[model samples]
Target: RTVYVNGAYLPETEATISIFDRGFLMADAVYEVTSVLDGKLIDFEGHAVRLQRSLDELEMAAPCTQEELLEIHRKLVELNDIDEGLVYLQVTRGSDGDRDFVFPSADTKPSLVLFTQNKPGLADNPAAKKGAKIISIEDIRWGRRDIKTVQLLYPSMGKMMAKKAGCDDAWMVEDGYVTEGTSNNAYFVKDGVIVTRPLSNDILHGITRKAVLRMAAEAQLKIEERLFTIEEAQAADEAFTTSASAFVMPVVEIDGVALGDGTPGPIASRLREIYLDESR
Candidate 1:
């Protein structure tokens, strides 16, 4: 495999970043991932926009133009011969002699890297067919959850907790309201109405979530962007999570309790079909 590091493409075995890079030392970096299907990048523009937003929020320098980034990504896909996979990109505050609370000198350039790899088809998992289970965890992340930063220890721990509980995913809850899954946007359907948390610093505004909303509107389904509690989710007729990779997948159970009939609901399936069609 080859990795795009700074201005050159290098073999993965040879690719390297400075040990003092803030992304590695202080986790001071932002990243984005976009899925590619049949050799074409899906929702590339949306991912680019979000990447820019994350950089701006962190007051970091833009390493390259969006067009340049797109070109790099295309070349990466070709170099890696990636067909059904994801493109990963990251920008970090450049290495410094030592860690400090203040930002690095303005003359220092941010490190930029990009790579691509295949993700197993979780959407087609037989467990997903029946719908998957999830467990709730406290949202113990920094307030800037909207930025796609590399500080993912909290979510990582949450996933471990979910696994120990025999759940497929973990939902982050704050003050009695469910925010989102560790790596996906959470949504639920109640009385035929689709509900999800509004875009805010409390959660990442997912591209797939936006696509699902658009699909729901086109399907003439009632959609609401509001906070729903764990109790409310457990009482929902259907539940699901969305991401660039997962697209749309139902949550059949939460906290070991079944939702509705413990089956993938029709609305979730229809939205998934619409999402996959439009994403192509």
Candidate 2:
């Protein structure tokens, strides 16, 4: 595979970052993942906009312009031959020769990196057919859940907890309501209505989430953005999640309880079809 590092394209093995980089030392970085379908980037503009928002929120500088970023994404997608995979981009505050609790000088340059992963059947994932079983975990992440930072240790641990419990993923709960899945935005359907938490600091505002909701609205699907609890989700007619990787994944069970015969619900399936159709 080929990767981009500080404006240079090289073999993945040759790409490197400083050990003292703020992104490595203090997790001071923002990142975005854009999926590719049919060798074309899906929602590149949306990802780029969100990337800028994350960078602005962190007071970080962009390594390059949006056009430059898009060109780089396309280049890596071509270089890596990623027909149906993802482009991962990261920008980190460059090293200042030493580590300190204080911020680096404004003159310090930021590091930019890009890479692609080749996924043969990213859109036609069989797991979407079987639906996902999820376990709920406490949301112990830092307060700034809105920023797309590289601080994924808790989410990784939550994924491990789900694996240990024989589930596909974990929904994080805070204040008795679901914040989101470990790596995706959470949602549920009930009585012909789609329910999810409103946008706030409580959850990461997902780019896929915004697109799915817009498509749902266009299809005249009813939506309710409010806080929901695990018990409510377990009793919902159906549930699903959205992310760059998994466009729309159905959830069949929650905390060991099955939802509607433990099958992927029709609404979730239709939305997935609509999403794939419209996105492609």
Count the clashes in each prediction: 0, 0
* CA shift of 111, model 1, Å: 0.6
Top lDDT hit: 2
Each candidate structure's TM-score, on Cα atoms with residue i matched to residue i, is 0.97, 0.99
State candidate 2's TM-score.
Answer: 0.99
Residue 247 accuracy (lDDT) in model 2: 93
Model 1 CA deviation exceeding 4 Å by range: 120-127
Tens digits of lDDT, candidate 2, 63-131: 999999999999999988889999999999887989998879987899998989999998999999999
Q: What is candidate 1's lDDT per residue for 1-280, written digit by digit as tens?
A: 9899999999998999988899999999999989987788999999999999999998899999999999999999999988788899999988666788799988789999999987555335466587879999999898988899999999999999988887778999999999999999999999999999999899998988887898899899999999889889999999999998778888999887788999998898888878877877
lDDT values, one for every candidate: 0.89, 0.94
| Position 23, candidate 1: lDDT | 90
Lowest lDDT sum, 10 consecutive residues, model 1, at 119-128
Deviation of model 2 at 16, angstroms: 1.2
